[model samples]
Target: MAEITAAAVKELRERSGAGMMDCKKALAENGGDTEAAMDWLRTKGLAAAAKKSSRTAAEGLVGVAVAGTKGVAVEVNSQTDFVAKNEIFQSFVRDVTALAMDVNDIDALKGATMPQGGSVEDVLTANIATIGENQVLRRMKRIEVAQGAVIPYVHNAAAPGMGKIGVLVALESDAGVDVLEPLGKQLAQHVAAAFPLALDETGLDQDILERERAIATEKAAESGKPADIIAKMVEGSVKKFAKENALLSQPIVHDGKTPVADVVAKAAKDAGASIKLVDYVRFQLGEGIEKEESDFAAEVAAAAGISKG
Candidate 1:
C-alpha cells in the first residue's frame, strides 16, 4: 500500500471532479498514482457522471411521503421530462423521498444510505452515468407536528405519491384522523391551487412587501391625493397584497370567500378539538431552474451546409 498525501487527493479531485473521500480512496487503491486514480474514478463512472453535472436539469418529479406525524417532500430533477417517467428514475425518487424523512436536509439525504447499498448520492451518480442524462437531487423538506397529523397531497401525479406538485400540510391538533384528514386534504388542495407565498403576512419576504409598497406608492402618487390620504391608500394596497399572497389570509379555494385561518378555526370548532395549522411545504417541479430553448433545425442546417431560412 502506498501513502496517499493531501496533494495527491487534491490533484485527483481536480482531475476527476470526485469528492475528497472518493479521491483519497481512489489514490489509496491506485498506489497513490494520479493517473491510476483517475482511471479508477472513470471506471467507477463517477468522473463520467460529474462531467455532465453542468447540464441544466429542469424536468422531474416532486415526491412526497408521510409517516404518521412527519412528512417529507423531495424534488429530483433530470435533463428531460421523459426520464421523469422512467421506472428507474421514479423508483429512485420514491425511495429518496421516504429516506428524506429520516434525514435533516438535502445534504444529509444525499449522504444517507439507501436500502440497496451505498449512499443516496452514489446511486444517483450511477443512475446518471447509465441513464445518460444530468440528474440533480435538488432539495428536500420535512414537516411535522407534535400532536397532530402531517398530510401529503400530490397534484398531477405520475404515480402514487409523486407528482408535478407535492404538498405537505402539518396540523397541530388532538382531533381524530377522521376530521384532520379531510380538512388537511382540502387545505393542501388549496395550497396547490393558490400558490401562496407564505403562511402569513409575517412569513412573507420583506423585500416582496417593500416592492409591493413601492409599486403601490407610485400608482397612488398619480392620483394627486393629499399626503396622509396617499399614505393610507398605499398602506391599504400593501395589506391587500399581503392578504392575497399569504396562505392564512387568502380565501379558501373551494368556497372562495372563507379565509384559511377562519376555515381552520371553524373545523376546530366542528371537531370539538383545538386544531392549529402548524406549517406547510409545497414543492413544484422545476420551479427555479432555467431551461434552454434550442433551435435544432438551424443547427442541423448549419452543420449540413444549407440555409434554414
Candidate 2:
C-alpha cells in the first residue's frame, strides 16, 4: 500500500474541491492514487460542488434563532436569489442558525455535526452540488445574557426564522419574559430596520470614524473657511456621523422622534424593570460579498455548445 502524503492530499483537494479530510480519506481509500481519488470525489458529487465554489454567492438568507437567553444569527449566501426560496436551502439556513446558538464562530459551526448526519461543511457541499449553485456559509454570531431575553426578528422572511435580514437583541434585566420579550422584540425590529453599526457611539468602529473624519475634513476644507471654523465643522460632522450610526443614539424606528436610548429608558420606566440593552447583531445577506458579472447570452450559448456569429 502506498503512503499518502500531505502534498498528495492538498493536490486532490485542489483538483476536486472537496474538504481536506475528505481528500485525504479518498487518497487513502484509493491506494494514494490522485486520479482514483479524483474519481472517488466525482462519484460523490463533491468535485462538481468544488468547481462551483469559485462562483460568487451574493444572494441568500440570513436566519435568526433564539433559545431562552441565548440567540444567534447566520448568513448563508448563494449565487442566485431563486435558491433563497428553495425549501432545502431555507432548511439549511434555519438549522445552521439554531446550531450557531451553541457554537462560537463560523469555523466551529462548520465543524459541528448536524443532527441529520455529517458535518455542516459536508452538508453545505452536498447542497451546492444538488442545488446546482455555489453556496457559502458566510458568518454566524451568538449573543447571550445571564438573565433576560435574547429576542430575534427576521425581516421579509422567505421562511420561518430565515430572511434577507436577521437581528438579535440581547436585553439583560430582572424583568419577566412577559415584559422583556415584547420590549426585546421591538428593539430587534428596530435593529433590523435601522441597521445600527453598534449598540452605542463607543462601540462604533474606529476605522469607520476615521473614514468619516477624512471625508468631513475634505468637505470642510472645500468651504475655504477659517481653520477654527473648519475644525468645528469637521467635529460637528463626526459627532453627527456617530449619532446616526450608533443604535442608542439613532432615532427610534417606530416613533421617528425618540432616540433609542430614551425609548429603552421609557420602556424600563413603564414596565418597572431595569433593562439594559447588552448587545445586538444584525446580518444582511451578502452585505460585503462582491458579485461577479459575465455576458449572459454568450455564456448560455457556450454552455449549449454553440458558437456566436
Give me candidate 1's TM-score against the actual structure: 0.80
User: What pairs collide in candidate 2?
Assistant: none
The prediction achieving the highest TM-score against the true structure is 1
Clashes of each: 0, 0
- Candidate 1 overall lDDT versus native: 0.87
The 0-to-1 C-alpha lDDT of every candidate, in the order given, reads 0.87, 0.84
RMSD per candidate (Å) reads: 17.4, 16.3
Displacement of the residue 249 alpha carbon in candidate 1, Å: 0.9
Please give the range of 10 consecutive residues that has the lowest summed lDDT in model 1: 48-57
For candidate 1, lDDT tens digit of each residue in 1-309? Answer: 888878668756876788999999988888888765765675565564121112232789999999889999999999888999999999999999989999998999999998899999999999999899989999999999888999999998999999889999999999999999999999999998888889998998897787667767766787889999999998998898888988999999999999999999999999899999989998888875767656799888999999877
